[model samples]
Target: MSVTTTTPETTSTTQPKKRRLRTPYFQVVASLAWKDLRAEARGREMVNAMLLFSIMAVLIFSFALELDRQAQEATVGGVLWVTIAFAGTLGLGRSLAAEKDKGSLDALLLAPVERSALFYGKMIGNFLFTLAVGFLLVFLLTVLFNVNLFRPVLWLIIVLGCLGFATTGTLVASMSVHARAREMLLPILLLPVILPVIISATRASTALITELKTEDWLPWIQLLGVVDFVFLLAGFFLFDFIVEE
Candidate 1:
């Protein structure tokens, strides 16, 4: 009787399965996002800059308006969204610029990771940072402007706004990172494109804060949802072209 070992063949068959388990789309994106989060947690350079810029911008806008109670409420929408845009742009630009400067982006691209997964990872990382600043802005806007900004609908607007902001901002940042003046170039490319999101967010937030009827707020919220969807879709499809260059 010849004793033949089938263990090698069985191990070879299971090898592919093990590899497949490690490379699921969600897991890859999670690992990539976690890499960024861990790095940020250790140094905190990006989050620190974003928070500082947002806080100062909000305070300046509050003081500059110099409005009466009614006037403050009227201008709050513009003030809040504008502050988030500024801070988010700054954060997005620096985050990608830092990656490009260190050549980590190239390494990330070289990995056997899906392009869409890479996009989501970067998009989620940017969104979390931007969202943090947005929440802080909400708190500051409430205290400084003496307006109630922490409503269910208003929080929804922040969620949608940050989602749209991060998607568009990340796409633009990847494109601008190779430019000579990426910090300057990022806003030029980013702000014009994200106008719809800003408008819809501002409108929805204003209506919610004003205690408008449900029907009135829903349309703007729907428009915000549409804008966020469009940008996120664009980022998902276009990230390959931008990064693979």
Candidate 2:
């Protein structure tokens, strides 16, 4: 039996498989944005401050201008956009500064995600915050200004304006966060860059509110769309360099 025994050859069937490294861009972006939203929601500090400031700004405008029916209808666009811009800036500054201060920004950078993902994440988060503030401002302004801001066109303007503002603001904030006076630097850097957006948004919104011809407002809307596209693309491309520095 021992002489007749044959040795069975064993073949190795187990081999280590190589994993293809996937860039978790969308996942990273969504996670980071969600984290910021959760933090902001839990604290409520940024939203509360923005809301209070917007209210105060509206009150000041109401009392300062004594906007009668005609004046209110005429200036509502400027008033609403100005209030939203200021309040939104406050939120953006706080959001980025908190991340920089907490060292979470570094951790985020260290993650195996594309830098553009981080930029989009921050921009989306800021956009949501500003959009909320803008919506609140629209509602309050409509009541105070006695203008019908609930129009669909006005909502579209708000969406476009918010997208433009957030795209530019996030990029500027990334640079300003590293500066010595980040709080001051952020607005200085951001406001100048986003002036085109503000002006175009205000004009487009005004046209919509006043029931002007679409042709008259089309240019402004186009300008806003162009500005948003440029900034969004620029931010996406420049984010990696900005973070590295």
Candidate 3:
């Protein structure tokens, strides 16, 4: 038998290849988020459903209420938050459920990565999808309600609000995915938990939309940020346990 020889050049090349398999934590997060993003871009299933729902909700509300200019400005915040909350819930459930159905979730679980990284990856994908719906809703509201919803402050609130919703939603969706009635169960479990965030976001958006004083809207915005941080912390600490089950 020929003797096995290990050259320095071969050893160095082989070692780097082995190390490459040990992916960095953030790289894992990016890869996972990118995977979901690519799948969503290719399929367009989740985002399209969410967009349709958002559009219908905006149209139905606008037609049903027939709000005057003043009324539109005043009520637009409520409409925006309600649409985001429901649509985000739909996207979140679909994201995780798709993984489960495809057996991809099991493979992800078996990968050499921190569970929290997985949570952040999933949360980032859900956040971006929901944020896209939120932006579309803003544009639709502007066109349909004849209100200018392009205020810098309002967009900031939407970002923070969607961030909070996605953080909490990702965790809850994971928990509900193993259930038979996950579609039903996710919202039931999620809406109640996310009610506080929705309320804060609604109040903040309403204040800003109605052109209230800084004192009026600032408190609500601050509260929204705090709630978002709490949820983020909760997801960070709790997601590992959730995925394990």
Candidate 4:
């Protein structure tokens, strides 16, 4: 009993431990998104490239068409989404390829965080970057081409289109990251798989900007919703396997 005396450090250790905080799934996703966003903020490389490319692409399309107001209205929808698709492909491919090439992607996968959460994190970051380009295109195209591109219906199309586009692009980029011709492989693989999103997005956007009829775009909007849901579900269930590969 006399030898049972404890040091202060030991006594402190014997006290009850504080409860650990459990992070919610949504918060985890946000953390992941924030991590990517923080890195992007520091670099400003990817967004700058995408923004410049999109602006030039829109400018080229605007001038190339040489369309009157009626023709401009009819074609602006295609130009906008096509620019987004092209710039989006480049953004997604580079973002993930850099992570994989630098070994950061492996480190992230080895983390205790869930894979679906990682997908959401990367997906949201990609979506936001793509949406930024979309917004810039809207502004420049509106001013340069004198077309109205800021309607609420078109906003909805942008939201949904970016969702499906980002999800599919992220998933495919993960698969293509290690490929030798990833630059070529990325778009070749991505465009075919995401064709539905492209079609529905273009159709709905055309209805909004060209026809100005919400009712006519409803079916295309529903199609986009279904495609986005399917892509997101696939990414959630399959990303772990892709990372493993």
What's each prediction's TM-score?
Answer: 0.89, 0.90, 0.90, 0.88
Q: Order of candidates by lDDT, top first? A: 3, 4, 2, 1
Q: Write the per-residue lDDT of candidate 1 for residues 45-110, one digit (tens) a residue.
A: 989988998888887887888888887887898888998998888789777788888988888777
* Candidate 2 stretches greater than 4 Å from native: 1-23
lDDT (Cα atoms) of all candidates against the true structure: 0.86, 0.87, 0.91, 0.88
Best by lDDT: 3
**Model 2 agreement with the true structure over 75-138: per-residue lDDT tens digits:** 9999988887889889888877898889988887887778898899989999998999899988
* Clashing residue pairs, backbone N/CA/C < 3 A, model 2: none
What stretches of model 3 exceed 4 Å from their correct place?
Answer: 1-21
**Once superposed on the true structure, which residue ranges of model 4 sit more than 4 Å away at CA?**
1-24
- Comparing 2 with 4 on TM-score, the higher-scoring candidate is 2
lDDT tens string, model 3, 96-151? 89989999998888887888889999999999999999999999999999999999
Q: What is the number of backbone collisions in each predicted candidate, taken in the order shown? A: 0, 0, 0, 0
Which residue pairs show backbone clashes in model 4?
none
**Mind giving the per-residue lDDT tens digits that candidate 4 earns over 64-144?**
888898888878888888999999987987878888888988888877678888888899999999989888888998998
Question: Which candidate order results from sorting by TM-score in descending order?
Answer: 3, 2, 1, 4
